[model samples]
Target: MLKQYKESSQQTYAYGLVDHLNWLDANRLTVASVRADHLRLYMNALTGQGAGVYGVAWRERPPLSNSAAANVATVVKAFYLTSNQADPSVVAWFSRDSSIPQHRRRAVTQNPLSPRRGSARPRFLPDEIVTALFEPGVLTSARDVMVVTWLVDSGIRVGGLCGLRFPDLHLVRDHPCGQRKDPHVHIVGRDDNPNRARAKAYHSWRTSPDGYVNDGVIRAVSEAMIGSFYAYLLDEYHPNQHLVDHEQVLIHTKGHSAGAALTTGGVRKMLRRASQRADLNSYITPHAFRHRAAANLYAASDFNADLVAQEFGWSRAEQVTELYGRSANRHTMKYLTEAWDSIPGRPTGRD
Candidate 1:
């Protein structure tokens, strides 16, 4: 049942199911005996306004945010579906489409998943934050600097960055794939990695890391990023004799785990500490770098949504234009207003 998802996603689904199981145990109900009413009670308890105890061990935990609730519902549904397929003896007890009688065909209001559309507004870091990240001493480690440079320049997800192998990088202008005017990195998903870092939904090249049978995508990197990467590899990474056999791009250089592969959470924590040291927003997330890169690419491409989408590996231009083009949109709106006001006989506010 867990084989369909990436390791990280499988872990997430496990946690969500654990939460549901905890609720069942606390309510003295068994999964085999559950029905729509029990599901409603469970959802109500998750929301924390219901009559029963919220969670078995979540007494101190607050109600889940809307997106989180929706995700939990999704995982729960998957669990039931997988279970049904695995063992049909268990009754088809809960369903997303199943409805409660009182709510006008709406699936039991309490059992229904929270609306998924109200996800938090996407945020992109300003240009100044990028400058701050690269400032001298802001990131003391070459590895940190290189990581930031790659994220901003390549716009790969943090997991993809963590999963990166040395051989996947074509930092030079030439490669077996073809000659390129610019350097680029190949992003692929691997299920066997110790760090569990992977590109979401990218499994085509899972078995062939450096082969032509890759379903992976290549993203161009700036010369500056390439320089930083080499500096990190030659100076920081290669010097670690312990990591001579390792293939991962970013490795630990401090503490007992020096030269070991870095996990995605460890990278986020490293960035947080660096941001704190630099007097920047400590809440600055890795994804914010991706957003900033997408926005910058959009603006630099003259608000060409397709160009931005291609650069960011988004299948749809709408994803780039609508979600990640805030900075470019600001520029676009300003230019439109300026052109309108400059027209001959255009009405002015004072007119």
Candidate 2:
């Protein structure tokens, strides 16, 4: 799950969790035995670094947004809770540990970084702007909508989206394709030789990290989109003549011929072009859609934070407080206008 989300090295987040877990095991601290203070300490450690040391991997790109850092913290916390479910003694230990400590953050004042500046930020389009972003054959054009929709609806990172396969999508309702809870649209990421022993459903290429589901999201992904994706696969993606079967979802164009699959870089390029057409400011990119969706859901929801988080496969809602922060309070004027004016032929100013 972590590997699938595009950002600074997503794998780093997963690996970091592993590193933290190993430390806990080495110290004889059970997962439920972990507490908020410990998680806070990890967060503080991450924040203390000069931007140079924070995560050199994302050179040229901006530091992970504060929201992203918090999310990573939440995932780490979940790692303990989920791993500790069998032991009640550990659970008691964590509750008494208390909340994260308040600390003044230091500025990341480093200049010697590696790679390109463009990589620093993963770009995305805002939802409203997306309607006008595509241009038939060009980037953000008609060809772009399916893949773009994949990012918006699935919220899967570029890598995961790139790792999808045709068999993964659920063409019919109720009956899951391949038995995975992941929507019928096949996730592209897969392990080199994953332990299929316990991996029946959730056919994501990357190993499973967390298990959170939002039924509303499942409901929002229309069957029409799935059908369109199917048409795309059959009409566009072709594995190859030599390969009897291949395991990838979104494929690349074969210079007028179909090829294996779209590369991660290719996905990024498409996103960039789409954002440009949408007339979004420089900051908006393909990834902005996920942020937008999470943000939109937070605003539109009836203060149902947990419900909103569940749809995005998020395990914790507390950290998303910022996303759901203002909510619909100020936006209530729209509702009021509709509510009173449409009261079954009620008198209007014009009348």
Candidate 3:
């Protein structure tokens, strides 16, 4: 589970599961023969062991998020299914009907934080905020401005942007990366090891290619941004090489030297610094730009979630529609004006 999720969070979960499995075996059920209902009971035992979150049925443990719980479920279920030491007695307890009935489970009041913790989605940036972020010297680094621009325009996640390669970009309209009448870029969801994952699909169960999502004005913007990043990489580090030996695009800047792909923590730090420079506050983050960009297109393009989702390489359009697509603000105002213009004015109505 830790290796698969790759979130620093799963470590605690791995630890908890290991500890509890030993406890479970001491009482009755062996680890391999654990069933869903038995698992629920085991979860309750953890509550007795101070796993519950501040006097509730939930665990107060650090990594006990709803998503983490879900991941734990997946991990444990996989563990039981794979272990081959279960006899019929073990299998009986592990039967499909082993889910704990509602009556037998922990009966307690729910805390909003306990289950179904939401995804970390930042709000969409307002136009004023973006314009503010780019004020002269607000971003001392030339690279910072470009990062926000690309993030907003391209709707690419911070991780995905950091993982991009130099060869993947095609900036000019006539270049191979360009889409006939549009600006385009080729990007993929590469794993920890970027070299071998080239041309592979991101989620193995899904069919979408890793090198998907190219062609749009955002594509051109991304290409331009990547080009700028390349310039920095060359000027600051390898001035003679055409191919960047490093796999990641955005590298850390240590005083005067070039570093590795701007890490997630570093990205946050950059935003914080920029925010301090501008001396204005609310919230500013990478995903904010992505959200705003999605809103921009959604507001302008007849509420097109499908198009936005595909271009952004989202597995579903629900988030785009529910979160991004709306009928108000600057974009809606312009749309409304155009709609009014299309209809003849000076109408007579019964007063």
Candidate 4:
């Protein structure tokens, strides 16, 4: 079962199944003897008195959320299916229409415990806020500014940023790095990164096949962003001591962990500190830049959904770009109306 799953996904499934296995052990219920009622009892226990968040141990904490419960149920169902696949004799016991009374049809068919997902607006950082981040003294060090710049320019996830390596960067305008015409950075997924930042995908891509590089997705970044990176490398980074020779892109500027790769938590902390220094009064997350960039691209491209989707690396099935189109069109309509109103004697009164 784990062999067919991605490393990250396998880790998630393994973690979720621990609770189910523990409950099974406590009740003396083997894979061959488990029934729907037993699973329901486990679900009840999950949300009963206390349960921590997803990926957390089943200890005395708050009750499991609807989404969390649904996730656990999904993992448990997958476990049973995998077990049955490993041994055919257990198939009848876990079948949807088996004679086992109290068998859960919902578990096999769908997750009834899952809440209906509602459409929610994507959060974005305002243009002013992003601009303020680059102003002198807004961030404590040049590295923070560079981090925020990469987030805005490339719109990569925090995990991708954390996993960035010096070799992955091709900032030169026309370097012989790969076939790509523009400057870009490669985002590679690795489970062994020191910072614990893993890319969402396993396959690696390159803009140009200049040479064999780390396996990961390639994303084009703005020249300004690349310049900011060099500025950090020259000023704050090289002058500081400790791990003078490192391959990671972003590093801890100060403290005992100086020169180490910045973890996801470190990135969030830097954002909070930068926001406070800039007097923004609101903590801007790295993901917010993704939404902002997507919406901005839609408006700039005259509400072209395909272009926005391609730029953001969203799959065709993920039609969430349509929502961004709607928002973009509203702004365009306002501009069109203003332009019409400016015409002399145009629609001065209702006809």
Candidate 5:
């Protein structure tokens, strides 16, 4: 798991596996002893359907959500598959014949308890709430403002945003790094970052011979984003001379951790606090801005999925279509209304 997945993902799997292990111990069941039926019972216990040996423990906590339970099932299945590989005697509860003849003879089957995934959809913040967030006194910190602006404008993931470095930003029309005609920022992935924040799409970036990143998921920045960044640099960022030099773009502005790189967790907490201060009814997460950006870009481009995918660094246009294609904007709504009204022999309520 550590070799195949990121540290964060591996940690999630480890935590889930621990719970499974504890449940197995309580039930006196080993990997070889557990069967598909037993695993289904485990899933039931997780979702508060059945409490096998730890009824008291189960009652203390709320049932896991369907998605979370599904994730646990996935982790358990993966664990068993890996265990089976390490020792052939271990029961492979999720193994089945491969559908493709040329592929491996055995394949891992999906957990019966895992929920079927629904079609992807945009989960964006409304324009009014966004306006309220930016209103005076709502978000006072220049750094906070910059962070929100970049998220909304660039649709960069929280991890990528926090992982940014000074060298990744080219805030001029003509930067020495590349031939881009506008200001942009690069999302680079590095495993050794002290904050453990990394770009989700790490494969999209590479350093050039001159120590400049000319190939990466480059996102154009809005003038407002640049202005807020400059404000943060001038008013908030004052790195201590004694600390070791690091080029992380976003750093703590106050407290003992001042000048340290901000983590993705910090960014999330900031957004939550800001949302509360703004009196927002719904909690606004960093990813909500990405959804808004994708929807807005899709609408602005006359519903062009390809353009939205390209702008947001999506690997496939199908991703944009599945996620943002059906997101209705004012323009789309108006067009549909007009088309409906223009249909021949259509009933008019007034008539």
Candidate 6:
């Protein structure tokens, strides 16, 4: 699983497996003996629809959300499939229906537990909340400000931001490293970082003979982002450079861990604290900035999903289109209203 998935994903699966294993123990059911019907019963218990022996364990907790339940089901199914490689009989338990096509049979048969994909809208921070967060005293440190600025301006994943190395940053235009004429940062995916902050995307990157990165996903930075970065460098970063041992761009600036590369967990904790200080009605997250940035880019690019996808390192515009279709609808309605108003003979609502 470590070779096939990111550490974070493996951790999630491990957690889900633990829950399943506990439930199985409560019911005295071994993995080899559990059938499709038993699995359905387990799902029912997870969803709070059935009272199994494990019900006592989960009685105090709320039922799993649709997405979370789906994840657990997926994890369980994957576990059995892997087990099936050693024992072929496990396949019969999952694919009991003979009518199902051979190619269509999946390890996890879809049931009521499956979540409807593409139904939920991506949550983003509102402009007013973002403005409030930027106000003086809301974010007290240059490092915090720079973190928010980069997330909002570039829409890079928090993992990518935390995983950044000094060599990945090309702050000057016409950098001696590559042919890109604008200031940009390369997001390089690595599994070996001491911080375990890995870039989600797997775009290939290699350093040039001159010690500059090339061929990674390049995220263009705004002037504001560059300014905040410099502020962090001069005001906080440079003063603490003597304590650093690694090349990662973002690092702990205080305590015994000062100068160590920051992790995704650290970024989340920082945002949570900043959000609380800003007196926000709801909690803010690092990915909210990415969502807002995508929406802003979608509107700024004249509703071009392709451009938004390219800017955000997405492999396909279809992913962007699905995520930002709501933005497109809002802009399209505004344009339609303006077009109607332009017609001289059109009746006003006042009439």
User: Top model by lDDT, which number?
Assistant: 6
> TM-score, each model?
0.78, 0.50, 0.58, 0.70, 0.83, 0.83
Question: Which parts of model 4 are misplaced by more than 4 Å?
Answer: 1-3, 11-73, 80-110, 205-216, 240-246, 278-282, 320-351
Global lDDT of each model?
Answer: 0.72, 0.49, 0.56, 0.70, 0.76, 0.79
Ranking by TM-score: 6, 5, 1, 4, 3, 2
The candidate, 2 or 4, that scores higher on TM-score is 4
lDDT of 3: 0.56
Judged by whole-model lDDT over C-alpha atoms, candidate 4 comes out at 0.70
Query: What tens-digit string does per-residue lDDT give for candidate 6 at 230-311?
Result: 9998988898899888888887888898888888998899888888988988778888788778888888888888988887
lDDT (tens digit, per residue) of candidate 3 on 235-289: 5436423334475656655543345456655776888888888786754777676
In terms of TM-score, how similar is model 6 to the real structure?
0.83
lDDT of 2: 0.49
Q: 286 in model 5: Cα distance from truth in Å?
A: 0.7
For candidate 3, list the clashing residue pairs, or say none: 51-59, 52-60, 53-58, 53-60, 250-261, 250-262, 251-260
RMSD of 3: 9.2
* Candidate 3 residue 21 C-alpha distance from true site, Å: 9.9
Q: Candidate 2's residue-wise lDDT over 1-351, tens digit each?
A: 464544334554676566556656655665555554454444544544353332122223344555455555555644544563525543444333343333422232111111112212223234456565544543532235677766666555555456544444455655422244434543332444111111112322422233322121122355546755756655555334333235555555555435545666676787666666556666344456666565567676766778776665555786346443333244577999999998996889893
What candidate 5 gets wrong by more than 4 Å, as runs, is 6-8, 22-30, 41-71, 84-92, 97-113, 239-244, 328-331, 339-351
- Where is the poorest 10-residue window by lDDT in model 6? 51-60
Q: Which ten residues in a row have the lowest lDDT in candidate 2?
A: 108-117
Candidate 6 residue pairs that clash:
none
